[model samples]
Target: MASPQPVDIPSSILIIGSGVFGLATVYSLCKNPLFKDTRITLVDRQPFPTPDGSSIDSSRIVRADYASPPYARLATLAQTHWRTTFAPSYYHETGLCITASGPEQKYVPSSLANVQALGTDRVEVLTSSDDIRRICGLEGGAPGSGNTGYVNWSSGWADAEGSMRWLRGEVEKLKRVEFVTATVSQLLIDHTTQTVSGARIKNNSSTSTTTLTADLTILAAGAWTPSLLDLRGIATATGQVLVYLPISATEQTALQSHPTLLNLSTGLFMIPPSNRLLKVARHGHGYTNPTTIPHPESPSGDAITVSLPYTHIDNPSQSVPLEGQRSTRTFLEQIHPSLATRPFAKSRICWYTDTRSGDFLISYHPQYKGLFVATGGAGHAFKFLPVIGDSIVECVLGRTPEDFKGKWEWPAERVPEESWEGDGSRGGPVGMVLSEEIAKTTSKL
Candidate 1:
């Protein structure tokens, strides 16, 4: 399908999904005097700041350590805004300590240099095992064990749920944007015009379906983007496990000063304790819900709450899978043995819409005019929050920056099979493809 030609700035915009990207788009558009009259309606399957949305997580990393220059620049911009405007509660500049073993450490020097190149003095190199221990409070630091990486004071983590809620509150205050609690069933398309007119949404409360009309529509549905737009090849939903350990008072005090630690070799990233809870997550090859079933325990008898549609199981009870729990325990045992045996405070399977390239997909649909996609985070778009919406605005106005022009466009095909194989954070091997019955019967693995 040929890419649809651009049209004039839209006066009526319908945005599906109110996660970071959707809220950011609303903020960006509403702030512009030129779009002061634009009517923006944002809809989500759940309520504002949906708990299951990838953007609505416990915490997200805020850093300027990307090996890619454009991303590095974007992170630097977002980091600055986060520190200045979002400092008090939402953003925490606890610092980030990233370690990679030999050979894989190629990105380490460049990552440090990238941050420094941003004209900041926040980067600190840890030269020895003791430096790692004293600076980050992680154990067993040897050459390449984590002692070799640097710590950047400017980089840290943000309270993701808080940040999204804050943004949603601000967006709600805007007169131009209306937040609707609804699920988008399908895109409203004008075949003759070859344009997406709007969307068909089901009100969560009223249970009534309404076709919302708009001059343009933006799909910022996060991990559910592929399911909404059939973007299987270009993007796929993958789930990552997050396990939280409730730390003791003493352990919490000792960890209060520790920075977020990321191990390149193991793809494990650990965030410092916040409210006595510490989070540890793996970066590669997360799971996904390709199929779904109704939850037997759902208050709404027919509510489908499973993460994947491919799964036949309709169980609603939530817990970390055995695999995830094992990984979390093993990593903690290696680095912080004291916290290894602590009971899990909570666990969740966070989903990410990963693209072949770790770059986000923000573009116009090739077959549908007026449909703009602002998804494919590849699990790392949160740090770019401050600037992402502006970029989307630019895309709508045909002013996408040269740096992002090709990088965020849809790939010609699903990433080549070999390339899709886990390459660090880009994600790992494809997960099991279960049958319908298997999906229904399968419990926590």
Candidate 2:
């Protein structure tokens, strides 16, 4: 497709966030001839490799198996990179077994059709619970983990942290982007002109606030994006649950090659064991932490309530609440009965910047001339680590993929998050408040 009418290239660009979107954009900017002369600056509150950031996790799914054909097609293209040049060592193609029970079963066949449409011939359809158990190595699990599903040997996972580290090294080798470590307090907005010039960043160690001015500013702060803007109903941060169980080498070797088992009905998934650690996470309507803060775009200090991320940084001793733990345990009993009673080595609350439709917000700010947003991961942006930056750059230059033109654009009107018709890929309970779940940590589900 032809590119859109090009916007004037800015002399300087500043990106806030070091996750895949931000870092990959840096890599793409360095490689793009149009941006070769643009002075780029990447600023993050934490040092390289954010300990609590969702992208810096042990694993992330890398698959083209999606109910949405556009995503499935794009993911298939990205999977080519994962299989070849982009962090190939970190990529593993053991397989992915996507399943569902009850109402979530509606998503399974559609996803299967998408993969088949992509010409993937390594798919094994499971028509019954026994088939699911057999393909996923869940014979030892409970009676029925799922009723229907498929195992795509072509689909796989990536070592998330390793891939990010490699990409960071690749970006550093280019030496085009000046990396800054500081916390962004607020945006430097030109209230009169309705433009964003840069941001007010504070250095934690020096205890001083400084201004970072750029001709163009891209906000790709993932779950923290809404905290810097008045995105109340437009987008919200939803914390998902994760539990890590340490297994013996003997057990790990036995299950290391098994396909990742994910049940959309319960939003529970278990990737294959690696490094003696097995992670169980949920891909669902996660828990929201509603916080009230000063409206970011208002000059007169207006308070707005939005769902923002609250992580271990907010509470050092925090762990996944009892409700999340119990839910995972119940799934474990169904999938891996032997490990149902096993103590978890650790737990975490990974947050997703969920938009109303689960689509990424990656376009110029409607109200601000010099600002652009590239966040809203919604729990599944990591797989695009290899090429999302180039796509973001395309949008920045007034050009977007034909398939994602409307999908990635900023909405013209605001809508309540609750009213969103999602991509039909999510499961689990809804309207779960984080505080409420945490409060029930003392009680059993």
Candidate 3:
């Protein structure tokens, strides 16, 4: 067997967005032996520490307690990459704690079985409520009794900003990579040829606009992805928010020692912070179009006043106040009465780019050739950025990726009929193959 020849691609590639996805993609591309000689330029509206930027938030937890095998495999691969390529101090593997109550709890068993079938050795299904208490210190448990528990040792938290800083540093070290502060205004597509040649970007100050040409362009603008694609007639769903709060000092101590906790009954997860704060947020719900909502130039003030439904509570559709921190505190108090008195240190709003099918819409535009769109992260997509970057790079290079078929397949249905389950297996079949390839390729570095 002969080795695959290195691809001598174009010298320049332009990436729009400086969030985790964009940054990770640029880092991976620069590191790839095939693109070692390629020059990469990343443009974003905000500066490096993008204020209120989705990627550089206070803290983000990483885990592998997915209901599906594909996600589990991706998480396993990403975790290994983060630990090996990035500093160990950047990530904390406290593990993951998942619990289910009432009829909703049935999903847990099937989810566990799926991962086990994939031969993942990181998960352990706890038999008794006592086991949950012993491992996670949470006292609630019952079959259809609003209580059930499971543990995954491969789950934990990572310093999101720290990770980005490390990645950006690496990318900057490459003589071929450059970062620019600007907003991409228009994608220059050759209509007759059906190919994207470059982009015209307006600086944040709006005093000047410049055009940069590239052989390929990638859209990783997070929540803004849909709007950008809209100019090209591609429709995308706006993703919702995940709010986090801090627990009491005592409870915080226990939770810090505890694994990342996900209560299926409430559709909420508690992530321990590396800096001693606790994060709680809801998962799987879609958000209204952010374009309809006001864009807050600043992260402070009235800009944060968007209404959010309390999906984690007993009532799924009930409307309530959008108290990012207060809601988190109240939910924690209900689950573990002990946290009622703890003062909230802070709160944050995170956004996800959703798709109609509840899966990521990472594919090439049917009409716009050479213009790759990576949106619809659906909510749990952050953990898969490393491999997702690999896939995106492959797509831009016009190579058939093992994971592309499954990812680009358009679903007949607009949105998933059922509620989004976090049991992990969302990535289409052939997930293991893609995951293994990513691990093998990335592990070499």
> All predictions: root-mean-square deviation over Cα?
5.2, 2.2, 11.2
Query: Model 3: per-residue lDDT, tens digit, 43-113?
Result: 88788977556677656667665555566667778888766766467788877777675344565676667
> What's the lDDT for residue 201 in model 2?
95
Residue-level lDDT for 100 in candidate 1: 64
Q: In candidate 1, what residue range of length 10 has the lowest lDDT sum?
A: 305-314
lDDT of 2 at 295: 87
Residue 227 lDDT in candidate 2: 83
- Best TM-score goes to which candidate? 2
Pairwise lDDT winner, candidates 1 and 2: 2
Please tell me which model should have the higher TM-score, number 2 or number 3: 2
Number of the predicted model whose lDDT against the real structure is largest = 2
Supply the global lDDT for candidate 3: 0.59
Name the 10 consecutive residues with the lowest summed lDDT in model 2.
1-10
Models 1 onward score TM values of 0.88, 0.97, 0.77
lDDT of prediction 2? 0.87
> Taking the tens digit of each residue's C-alpha lDDT, what string does model 2 give over 1-445?
1223338988999999999889998899999999889999999988989988889988999989888788898898899999999999999999999887754367789999999998978999887888888888784543336787889999999999999999999999998999999999899999889889999999889888999999999998989998898876678899999999999998898888888988887788999988899999989899989888888888898898888888998899899988889888888887788888999999999999888777888888877878988998878889999889988999998887898877888776788888987777787888999999888885653
